[model samples]
Target: MSKKNLQARDISWLSFNARVLQEANDPTVPLKQRIRFLGIHSNNLDEFFRVRVATLRRMIELGGKKGNMHLEDNPQAILDQIQMTVLQQQNEFNRIWEDILKQLNKEKVYLTNEQNLNKEQQEFVKNFFDESVRANIIPLLIESLPQLPYLRDKSIYLGVVMRKTASAYDQKYSLIEIPSKVVGRFVQLPSPPGEHHIILLEDVIRFNLPYIFSYFGYDHFDAHIFKVTKDAEIDIDNDVSTSFVQKIEKGLKNRRKGKPVRFLYDKEMDAGLLEYLIRRLNLSRRDNIIPGGRIHNFRHFMDFPDVFKAQKKERVPFTHPDLQKAQRVTEVILQKDVMLHLPYHSFGSVIDLLREAAMDPDVTTIKITAYRLAPASRVINALINAARNGKEVVVMLELRARFDEENNLEWKEVLEEEGVKVLIGVANLKVHAKLCVIKKKQGTRIIQYGFVSTGNLNEKTARVYADHCLLTSNRSVMADINRIFKYLENPKTTIQHLRNCNTLLVCPNAMRKRLIAMIDREIKTAKTKKTAKIYIKLNSLSDELLINKLYEAATAGVELNIIVRSIFCPKTDQRRFKQPIHAVSIIDEYLEHARVLIFHNGGKEKMYISSADWMVRNLDHRIEAAVPILQPAIQKELKDIINIQLADNVKARWLDDELSNNYVISGDEKKIRSQIETYQYLYQKTGKHSEASSH
Candidate 1:
């Protein structure tokens, strides 16, 4: 928790990314999954640079003093460390790609280039390029334009240099942005039955470059792939005259012209063209001008063809045992609390809960929080329908969800037009709690019941992200939910309204104080040599004060077992501690997105499912919720799930002091692949995935 023991968040993120790279490097993984891992790693690094590294650079420009830029002790040192670490990772990435490519060749899955195309494939490529790609592209003659065209983020371009062999004066430079966004990135060519031939979209264009510039009559042509990353952190001005919506729109527009943070180019690019680009883009060698392989935007490979005969079918989420037979999800929740584990349980149940509430004549009101939505969000549709059906609906949509501002902003207008009262939440605090409250009138009284989740309501993510949602009608929990919504409905009201949430831990109000108090109890128990235990599962753990609290408990000989997916900053190398702290990270097919806190209060266990990660942002600057699980069955089930992850010997890696992501190996114990084992466990409990549900 001290500055000496804290791992830089940016540095820790890259180390976490190295775990993704290891997935690509592992030979045990299927070839397609390994390739996807590479794409995921590439995408993660891009965001890290655009957000975290870019922030650090701006801090350096503004004179990075202590207590500035998220209170990091040193910004320049972290940036330097990032450069060295990224370079080393890039080399490893290239090496892994070479190995994957070799494996692909053995499977007769060839990524054919323009020069390596067969006679039939060559004809196919040229025709496909002319038919689909030519019209979408407008090649800009670099020499003719007074200034270079604005380079779009998340795009790749083919920097072209054309010339006639005999006349050096006739040479000219042009730039063509690869129309991958318009057309697909991977082009499957005509191939024999057992052989799969695919080519990159850039290569197809490269093969027909002469035809594109036929008007100029160039004989020699060279094209190389290149891309650039820009600072994606949007800055909203504090001008009192403009509305928040106007500021967000303006910030989005200015984001396109953000300062270039990294410029990546093919290592084999011509010196003349490369130099011209650097000069035009105002980039220096000191900038992150990385020299990479032929392909620049390999992130597109995430959707690479399923041409390879798949060895494993993707996991299918099943219906929860409690809801598999219930015609009404609300009915089941009203009887007893239910825990829904996502990506293993059908997200349809959540949607069903909302849809039933929308149509139910007894339902009187609905209040929910929205941080992210799928492209076609059924949750939104249900809420809109509820408003049309004469039920009062309130959506506390967070407009500041990073990278989702535009989408959330668009949804805000739609909801407002449909008569849904949309609250953008209080200033300086993002409403991140995934909560819903649905009220229904029975006889004379209106009763409240709904759900609290660890992930977004987006159905798309629920199919992949591992999260927990508690469907409960607990009166105390519903009261706290209403209290929180009341606070959000009017921020100008006194802050005392949020203090009434006794059943739930509300961040920026009571979460921090309550968490520390719980830890203090464990520390006291440890000092007394009584049974003391704490189990924590979160996506990140970076709050220095809270981490130091954990360190204090560890120093008192408490048995601490922590499972964190990313950005953990604990030094578990203390000799004075009575027990070795078990800090591990589990990275697998599904993201570990749930947050749980369990404390052994003497003998009785206290369990909670929360939406907040133990980070400075979550605890200090965000609206989050932590709900206690009172159902004995649900508590035991949640404990069973966390134990599976703790016992994982395959994907879980020890979070050692050196940041070495060494896998936790079991010498003789049964191999428990938690994701698969979780599915089996749930299937046995519900008979799910064996037959269709009657609902």
Candidate 2:
């Protein structure tokens, strides 16, 4: 592949986010939902800088120009482009927010600032500030302090400029960190009978500036909302003696002091104040300094108050029919294969299976590899209970799950205390695979039951993230899983212990090679004039080697289609590949997170549920897994889900040659909101709900 065939992964990710921004701008969406989309876009950008941009910066420092030679533009140049694009997006975001606010007002809900408060609203604001906000406010006198206080990454701050009326030149600068984390960002005020009123915490603080700075002997005051996004990449020291958990803990502390990658302030901020902040923070002009609205952390909108009537929001969430009240989850798995589609299908089935395995006298051992887990994880509890029940419970807890390292470490300590054998991942490689295997005695034999998922076993996230989990009692796959656990326990052990895996694809040693080989087979079939097609749904697609191979397969006449939720670096131009890839990204009610790959192996199709994306880290550095969907029923279900997502004309946006997020509208035809439609499909299939009688 040549330079023109590839797009920068970072740029491509931004394009995907632009698709999210398009959702916010789409008037067809509900007002509240649109604001939530804006929040998601902002939150996504924050992580991109903290992790991805930080990695690029480190690469530039280590490899210099030579490292960036393969990139279409240098890191600095890409940063500039990101800044420009973000600024434009910010402008659009403000417009959409204003439009939403107007719609909200028409619905009898008003968002007012400090200056727009009525007498009753003023009383409510003052009381709320006194009771909730005053204790959390810690004002730092900037001029008097000896050392500058370190600002937290992605935290909003208020820059205060205090001027004394007695002397024209007597002025002081101060800073106050917004306690949005403690007291909620949105404050509801008593409204006139039949009206709803709300104010931002920033504005509430803005309302009572005199009360906070009464001791400062200043008669005049002004403050501007500002925020800084720092590089959140954790750099662990390579010390042999330090435990992986300790290293992660130490690295998390170091994350707080990371260099700022972006600075954002209110557009109407005083020019002198902005300049002073830039100088004091040592922020270069190129460090993505943006001018945003008064409110910086719109991510709070994700938890926006449900103050209105129940009917005002989207319809009530439905439980997945298959697992709504599964009485014998493990028994069903033992008898036949079961597939779970998250959000659409309840994640309770996974939990119920574990719980059953814990209490089952026939079960002897339970093993799993965890990457990211929920805060109050039922998964961990079930494993602990299994260990307490005298079952051999082995858990490979990856301590290097970025941003969740601390939580994972805490879980590790808890699990270890509960007598569960915990492995803190393999050396130099993070175990990114999500696998759970249970050994149970049935009749005259010990059967191995296994589960493979495309997402973390986190119930909290499973409620909103679209993922797939395959539960199977296939002997061959279970043996391969046993081998994986053995290798994880002792890296030097030969993987030859279990090689009868004709149904699964394990990574690091074989996944990439197997995937390439599969593509090659498809290419051969295509050349022979047989029906050849390949469909992939992944979070990201950036590995150049795999991408180039995909292009080759595309040129060989394989029908290629991709549904990437985040990043895609492949060019869809005619000059680059023989066929233009049909690609779209769906940013809808639920996050599209599953990694599924389907290939037309002659007439019979092959489907897989993978814990790995087609990224270099997943393929080369991490211990990942992608298990083949062997059951015909499960394969058909996976294919159906992918097809539903592809047919999404409402929430799906095309990833075009120019990377513009153009909505895929089927022009006045039936609208298909994939998330909702998928939920209905699963509900109907499982007979989870009964129909209402005709009136």
Q: Which has the greatest TM-score?
A: 1
Candidate 2's C-alpha runs over 4 A off are: 63-73, 312-326, 492-502, 575-578, 688-695
User: What does candidate 2's lDDT look like per residue over 644-679, in tens digits?
Assistant: 889998888887778888878998888887876776
lDDT of 2 at 426: 75
TM-score of each candidate structure, all chains considered together: 0.97, 0.94
Residue 170 Cα positional deviation in candidate 2, in Å, after optimal superposition: 1.4
Kindly report the root-mean-square deviation of model 2 from the true structure over all alpha carbons.
Answer: 2.8
Q: What is the per-residue lDDT of model 1 for residues 614-677, given as tens digits with 9 covering 90 to 100?
A: 9888998999999999999988899998899899999899998899999999999988778777
Which 10 residues in a row give candidate 1 its minimum summed lDDT?
686-695
Q: Which residue pairs in candidate 1 collide?
A: none
